[model samples]
Target: MTARWGNACDIVVFGGTGDLAMRKLLPALYYLHRDRHLHPQTRILALARARHEPEAYRRLVRRHVSQHVASADFSEDSWGSFSARLDYMPLDISQRLEFARLARHLGDSPGRVRVFYLATLPDLFAPTALHLHGAGLVDDQARIVLEKPLGESLATARRVNDQIGSVFDESRVFRIDHFLGKEAVQNLLALRFGNALFEPLWRNGHIDHVQISVLETVGVENRGAYYDQAGAMRDMVQNHLLQLLCLVAMEAPVHFEPEAVRNEKLKILEALRPITGMDVQDQTVRGQYSRGRRAGETLPAYYFEKSVDHDSNTETYVALRAEIDNWRWAGVPFYLRTGKSLAQRKSEIVIQFKSVPHRLFPGTTPEGNRLVIRLQPDESISLSLMAKSPGRGMALQEVELDLHFDEAFKRRRWDAYERLLLDVIEGDATLFMRRDEIEAAWRWVDPIIGGWQEVYRSPKRYAAGSWGPEAADSLLERAGHAWFDERGD
Candidate 1:
């Protein structure tokens, strides 16, 4: 498939030498170039303090990008063209004097889209924007892309937003949550709003409950310090899981424009019933992983990870029941759980429908219809329905109607970063979060964090290879529903 190219733009990556840039950003750009999604004139400027000539930087990037990008996608011919668009500049983002060098490198190109991708820490976000604006780099056509863990808490998030908002318009700021860039996630929006088959039956009356889980097989690894500080709630739930929940529970936007979609999402975030104080104990579970074997390999516990505190109380896993108090989803509970070092690495959304009011077949048992959307490892959508057994009278069995992206489409699937990068260049914010949306999400998540700090001083311990704490299973069991992992996908 020929990938579509957006407007010619200069993509400036702040932390160009960082893990995210080398592993995701550069590789995504390479695919965009290979697939013809990037204009020939588009430039990718690496802005970091690491001093390197253009040739040396390209060589470094080539090694990392080659290692990370799929073997089939990496080609000498494509690399030649992609490498030509690469440039580098060494500077301290904190130093206002370094801004002039960046501006000079960008040149005085008119009407070209400029995307400042802040892949650096949250602290640098505002300063970078300020520096850009001070150096006359900010323009109407300029857009900024921010990464996750926007802030440590609600107050800090607000401050960050205020600082960034001062320099760039909200429309031009793309607060990216890569989960929204996943193929299954986009397909989910299409499944809910594009199709008439599920829309009417998507509410409380027909759907029993919703489960959104993002489980990781790997522990903190190199992110021990950051993970300890942020934990699962701030790192995963505040952005990824909550964004998925909003997409699942939100009302159909009048149109699929950026604001049209975000407006409805904002409504869902606002409608989220607060899980605070006593509610936190009853509705939420936080777990820290202990030493255990995964896939025949023994792994250290969260506390023992490099740079992590020996007695860290930080949660490696979190499970919470979120309710949206709105007409579309009044009684329905949205079960959200995300963790590291789990049974497997998978992200999926399960919509289990309510069972039939009365079973007509006496000799057979009917299972409720379920729509399972898997987001990682393998991207596919499967709907489980009860059907009559092939050769038996009155016998029913569950059958799945599945759509696997790789098998169904016979083309290379675009990574989340590739799609998001293209969207930023195209000036599309539909897949990105707005400032109000961020504030609202923090508003909903703040109290939960506070509740954990005040009441639950330490997280429950679970084995590294396990699903999560037993409390998480009991969380679902109390309501007569088990996690999809526990129930068998």
Candidate 2:
């Protein structure tokens, strides 16, 4: 069934009944509606092959939203209003007649903003866009949203971009990476540029090294099929971790607008010193998680995960030291590590400042003055500095000056999807990945992958409950550094 609001925008979700839709998108939309972020006239249309009436789909969404959303934020009145904006259509995207029917259902409104959010597989992105174009559904007011890990490799990514470009102009395309939407991630800009305290020391002269880690406590129990093929390199490193790196390393933009912000990010990506051949062996470490115990419970190894090959050589963990060729970060190593089934679930960036040239109180602080930006579990920014211990003669101890966003702001932090989805609807591409940005990231990543194929065939094995293989620690230890273990440290 199809319904329309008079001349308002139509936000169509391609994979309306999928996990992403139920868990992230619809719940986000509900919040936007509840908070009055969406326009009063806007209508949400969910497109999928799942056969269901409009009300049936809305009920299904209600159950999910209730489970995912916080009790304080959800209410019966808000849900009633939000559900009224939802409409569902059971149409197979591959069928031309289905698209034709969709066209008639949407009708032609030149002024209406039509957003086609493709939450399906990357292979379907181009075809769906072409289908929309062929059915006379695309216009100047139309925009398309594509999810991350655009393609498996550089070649496929370019091909997908080219195909989608043929239907929608670059300005009309939005490639989303939800990591960019995190509040703490965005606060990096304000911390670096908005304040004069840090920008001067943001370079190699004052900084020793940088660490970015996106660790998880869950294994690939259900996503084993996709995880086995892509591994940690393609799955996390290629997009999310890289995007975070760009933001942290990027030069201040002339303006905070879309193109200005993206242009600066692009420069950082291009300046990344490529890791290839022998450098891959020296700077990169890949590992597969082995079954182990954590917190008195046994965990399964990557090989035992559902849909994974017993002999799969895919890496469940990756740790690498990256450097930028540009002057600002020339000598500073940006260490990135990500893995599944780790001891903790947290995503963070640690900026280790250089120790005092002359320490008056020796052995007081071993970890040097540092700035830590926590992105998940809890979002906060903290700076660790040495303070004089009570009733002591210059006895120093490390104390953190912390700023928790929730406690400071006194409001609910919007979900990453909530901010990103609204950004798409309003045509603000500042937080999105551009076509060239995606390609540049792949170019830097491809050489490391190629080196793995040629020499490093099988990934080393580490206990599932541990950080990663011992080699990951060795990767940093050679440079007189170590992985920043939040819990241990």
Candidate 3:
């Protein structure tokens, strides 16, 4: 479907004073506004318990936006024009009376497309929807955006969906997974389907294994309480990593529209070989970060993090082998891993092709061709090829043909949130997760979580600055493969 870009819209962000608003949402909105991507009649309303007036809130937003957005992009002229569209309201969502005030504030603009972005806790998602419905604000033009950690498990996710679905139709609900909005992730689709080179060989016979890792150098700073309960598995793997896996493994859709794309993703999630019973122990590795040193500074253990239990058994890392039980990817393994307070900050996917049938070089046994798609620490796609060294008897050396997005585009790349927020405003659910997609992800993840509780009482410990527990390495080593480190090796 085409975007509803020209339509007048109202963008209402709940928890407008929260960290997500300051660091991501508002800054993204600022860029959209500066670029004139937003409709001329569009109005942005931020609702929070903070009692700042509209002008004061704009000033506060200006400060935060200036800090988060690059100085090269920020300017007084743009802020002045953008701030004209900004407004604020103070209300407690839990209070039923507050809805009346919000409805009255909106002043009966049924023709305007309304987007209610819930940047609050997952628990607030359903209630906010119900409140909006009761407040007579759930018109046909209204849409709702939900943030991640949708629920702790499948049951809770269904519960949230049922509750929110009761108020807003599934089509009007946007389940945001910011990872899918990244240019590199979208380019995976382009690189696969757009190019004739990869599709034919993108199967088990040609590709050996896939490695998807999202590593971080920073620990759970203020989210220790949430992290302890959710951990790396629920927080990162269930949504981000699985979504990446789907994009890599899904079949070519009939068309590039929302349902067509999501249907393919659902098939991949359903075809995932279930890691249950004894399989979990063999295919999965979980670890908690312990105190260690990185660079010149010492990093604290997960247990010592603020709001975390001292003896928390929560895992801060996860590595698992996921297989698609389909014709295209039957035997190929997709290694998914993510961790906090690790050696580096990177989000990348490594597609390792199978080795050549015969070695042509007499002295050198060259490695297979590899494609690396990096999403963060710079967005780029590089293919590793074996090239002959200078003046040698068939000596082979690995070289990369890299296409960095910034260098090639010669323009600022849109932050994931920036693109996603604009998509939501324009009523495009192509990048958003469907209700079935969310439940399907939870269905695949729930069994492993149960396996962890039943079989492994405590996660294995690894140094904070290390890649992960040694077991993660061995998880691949058994298959004669190794986790591809950041150095492209």
Candidate 4:
């Protein structure tokens, strides 16, 4: 399946019949095909447990592809050419013999890259990797992609890693944290390192506080089976939020390579002050969303989902006051929260600067600038600064120096999937999480989760459309701060 498309070969997508494939993967591949990004003979072989011929898979894909792809220039000729590269193989991880067909289909294409994408559940990752090795699909240059919710805890994550490590070297594994592929997230690094102005103010003395939030307006759609076992802490904050913390808090590395950048991120993770013992209650807020409105529609609570336990202690919303115990960010507090069924969907980092030393006029407004890096709903950066209200009097107010993606960049913005997929093809691991980085994140995050089980009897309940539990606001209220909104940016 390897193609002459500039040295890359077939992208062997496992769980190709899953949600991610139907919505994001195939559509992206279609666009890549339409734009001539793929090589002349490049192929995309989809593997799944369903019994289907290549033609049947093509039909199934055609229906979804037509729906997800917009009206533009997908001609019959283009689809025919793209469909010619479409292939499928039925697979069940538990059955060893089933993988033999997969292996035979992938015949020896020396130097042809084989990209294995694991979109299935975590439990299936190890078995699939071993089966790949057993089927002789593991090569020195082959690549394997691992999706997140890495594991329930550090121990389980390590166990999964050990299982996968047995078959493939660390270099061959690509751990995707789609957040990193976000344009603004990547741009944050560029802003900090590329600009001479920001780095000087990036330290403790000049900065007052940092806030990171990744909220969702939608409820757990059809993931109740998985959501019940893992709450907001493990499902989102542990991997995604912690990684964002690393990116924002990590010291700049000399080089931007995978290991170099991750090394600095690991240091920031290691420098994270542990939140175990008694202080857990003071520093963290955990809650579950009850029924409420979202995106102009009513939504149910976490327990309302089918198959969810009535007495579940799993949290749907979480807010924490984390501190990095390093010279660069000694006293600055990094507040992070993520939840489902909230007021609005927003993923942003707000840097609230310290107030000016002295104020000359009694009635004059005080000045404080905040740098907001937003990820979703929109991808942009805005610096909130003080401006004089237009009048005869010297009244002060806030104005923004904004870099909205639409106004700033005219090119078609790439989705997180596209950037991450390209990174996989080009072997760029800067945006991908590495072994130690994942382990370290879990190491720091596991204790916070474990602490709640021992101390907090139950998760505080917030309305589905509410902005998490009332307790979440208290985490910052005592520090004289509040969460950012669309207008606040």
Each model's Cα RMSD:
1.6, 2.9, 2.1, 2.5
Best by lDDT: 3
Report lDDT (Cα) of residue 261, candidate 2. 96
Q: Considering every candidate listed, which one attains the maximal TM-score? A: 3
TM-score of each: 0.97, 0.96, 0.98, 0.95
The window of 10 residues in a row where model 1 has the poorest summed lDDT is 480-489
Cα lDDT computed for each candidate against the true fold: 0.92, 0.91, 0.92, 0.86
lDDT of 3 by residue, 237-344 (tens): 999999999999999999999889999999999999899988889999999999999888999999999999998999999999999999999899999999999988
lDDT of 4 by residue, 287-338 (tens): 9888787557888878888778887888888899999998999999999999
User: What overall lDDT, based on C-alpha atoms, would model 1 receive against the true structure?
Assistant: 0.92
Worst 10 residues of 2 by lDDT: 1-10
Can you tell me which runs of candidate 4 are displaced by over 4 Å?
1-5, 73-75, 294-296, 362-365, 486-489
Candidate 2, residues 382-443, lDDT tens digits: the string is 99998877994877888999999999998789999999988888789999999999999999
Model 4, C-alpha of 257: deviation from truth (Å): 1.5
Error of 2 at 114 (Å): 0.9
Give the higher-lDDT candidate: 1 or 3: 3
List model 1 lDDT by residue over 254-347, tens digit each: 8889999999999999999998899999999999999998668898888889999998999999999999999989999899999999888999
- Cα-based RMSD of candidate 4: 2.5
Off by over 4 Å in 1: 1-6, 486-489
